[model samples]
Target: MERKQHGTGEVVFNAINYTVFILYTLICVFPFYYLFINTISSNELTGLGLITFYPKGIHLSNYIQVLKLKGLPRAALVSLARTVIGTAATVFASAFLGYLFTKKEMWGRKFWYRFVVITMYFNAGILPWFITMMNLGLTNNFLAYILPYIVQPFYIILIKTYVESIPQSLQESAQLDGAGYFTIFFRIVFPLITPILATVAVFSAVNQWNSFTDTLFLMTDSKYYTLQFVLYRYLNEATALASIIKSSQGPVNMNLQNMQTPTSVRMTVSMIVVTPILLVYPYFQRYFVKGIMIGAVKG
Candidate 1:
């Protein structure tokens, strides 16, 4: 009887846990779901605020319109290229620095570690950074987007923690076999910490992909604008129905002529920008989870 009672309690607890989990997940995902549904919904239905859980009418016209705008596609491509290259470079650099920091014998190790950590809290604010970029001639260039954030302190710390957790015995054994630091790091340490590397790569990629503020401040050329900046410009320039009707030559139903609602545009832009990340997220999610677990356990 006690065994059966315990089993029943376990089932009940699991049921409640799953219910809560599903509810929380839905809460988190509903905004994106709404954005997607509203983006593809017909402008007429969207103006009525009729789109909630599902789209009332389907139309790809908004996407077509947005794509037709100048500089958007180019900006997207630029952003994509920057994200791939920047993530790769940043990951490699972080891993190297992380490995170095894990070794106690490295010269000026304490100072270097402290300097890296200090950067996380103390940033040279935007104006100074902009001035520095100008002096360096990085303004209006692709490097403007990629150079400033190449080395992230938080990511380095995470990688260092994961690297330190790697059993010293493995490295010692490799050294006994006449292997150098480079060989051990590349062959043994890197492979063992693939999970953390993936996690950091995903994080860096996402940051670079969604980046806009730096581009806005640093990029003077239209060609260098990122997707987010282009989208922001579009949002700012989107015409209202009243403005359109005033410019029209013929009489129009001003009341019935709906405004170009920014809500749908915002949603569409968000969906477009976020689609790649969502697609790539699942592949690296396991790595992030595994990395976190390993770090937490061994840290």
Candidate 2:
């Protein structure tokens, strides 16, 4: 193979591209880095705005103390349950509905797809939505998190577009082998559509994991609260939380080293809330662009 030679203009363009991307990456990463360093640094120094760019007086006590906070574990469990259940339900519903809509034999296919897609443009206002959920008995219910998100219009559209891009003959061949729609979907179409499904799953999981608004509106019970909601509350009531910690530990034993300042508490909670999504993002990143591009452009 012949090595391609770069012209001066091409060299300059490459330099600019690398510089721009590197700067952009750092800009995106700095906030998370800042939060992490602040959480691990001395509370006094953090409060004084002294720790930046790197951690100082490093200790794990902030995480330890935050974990010891009341209801944190339960809230984490609730958040995990909803993320798993909601993401699964959303993926399955999107795949099934997306496939179903592509079938010409299905009754009212166009109309139903249109009806579902139209939801992306508009919804009943919050008060009406709340009333509907209340009527449905979703208040303080775990199903509130899972049910409403199952049929997300945008996800359906993405899956539908990707499914349409699959060769029609694959489904035809499965049908010819006496496979029904469900069997065809499972045996053939499903495996082939993994990329798009992964993309949708990432999206659904993040949305489910980060959601706190539903908890605010529908949950009066702390038992049903999610980690995100707990974090939201922690951010709002950082001073109260610090006071609670201080009182629980006894003021006499508490020193500057063991203290839980509002700033430290806020940063620690934010870091805790953000870590999972950051960990999970890289896994799905490979499929994300390819799936979304095909889904968007082909549709």
Candidate 3:
């Protein structure tokens, strides 16, 4: 009787926990949901604050207008290329360094680890960074975005923690079979830590995808502008009178065309910029969650 009562209590507790979790999830997701609904709503309805829960009128013209603006597709492609290549390189380098740090016999390991840690809290400020990039002739180039932040210390630490949790006996056994460090790392270690690598890849990719400041500061060439940079320029131009009357000869009336309601356009731009990450996330979500749980606890 007591055991049955205990089981009932545990079930009730779990039910309450699940209810709270779902509520929190909804709270977190509501903003994005609202953004999507508002983007498709008519500007007049949105201006009157009528687009709270759902779109008032179904109009797809905002998306069309955003796309019709110059440089949107090319900027998206630039962002996509940067995210894919940068994330892959970051994962490989971080995993390799993580494996190296996991070894107990490596010389001056403490010193090297401390040096990496110091970088986490300190950085050469923006001016120096800009000067250094200029000196290296990286300005107005795609490599400027990719190479500057490829290896992040926090990612390295997470990977190292996951690597440490792998059984040391596996490495010893591989050595006994005449395997060197490269073989052990490539053939044995990497397979076991696939989950953690996937998690890191997701984070690195998201960071690179949403990045705006770096591209703005480093890339002056119109051809190399990332999606976020283009969106910012579009937003600024969309609200300016010059943009509306660029092809017109006479002074443009702001009240006549009603073009100031570019809030919907901004929302549409945001949706476009974020759509790829949202699509890719569900595929790796299981691995990402599992890796976080294991890596965090193991560390």
Per-model TM-score, in order, reads: 0.89, 0.96, 0.88
Candidate 1 Cα outliers beyond 4 Å, as residue runs: 1-6, 240-261
Could you give the candidate ranking by lDDT, starting with the highest? 2, 3, 1
Candidate 2 residue-wise lDDT at 192 = 87
- Predicted structure 3, TM vs. truth: 0.88
Candidate 3: count of backbone clashes, pairs at least 3 residues apart or interchain:
0
Residue-level lDDT for 174 in candidate 1: 89
Model 3 Cα shift for residue 29 (angstroms): 1.2
Candidate 1 residue-wise lDDT, 170-214, digit = tens: 999989999998998899988988999999999999998888898
User: Clashing residue pairs, candidate 1?
Assistant: none
Could you tell me the TM-score of candidate 1?
Answer: 0.89
lDDT tens digits, residues 1-299, model 3?
A: 46545588898999999999999999988988998988787766776678899777777756765676677889988998999899988999889988888887889888888798799999989999889999998989888877876778888898898888888899999999999999999999999999999999999999999889987888878999999898778667655523443333234532322333656666778888888898998888999777877757632
**Per-model C-alpha lDDT, please?**
0.80, 0.92, 0.81
Worst 10 residues of 2 by lDDT: 290-299
Measured with C-alpha atoms, the lDDT of residue 116 in candidate 1 is 90
Candidate topping TM-score: 2
Question: Which portions of model 2 miss their true places by more than 4 Å?
Answer: none
Residue 208 displacement in candidate 3 (angstroms): 0.3
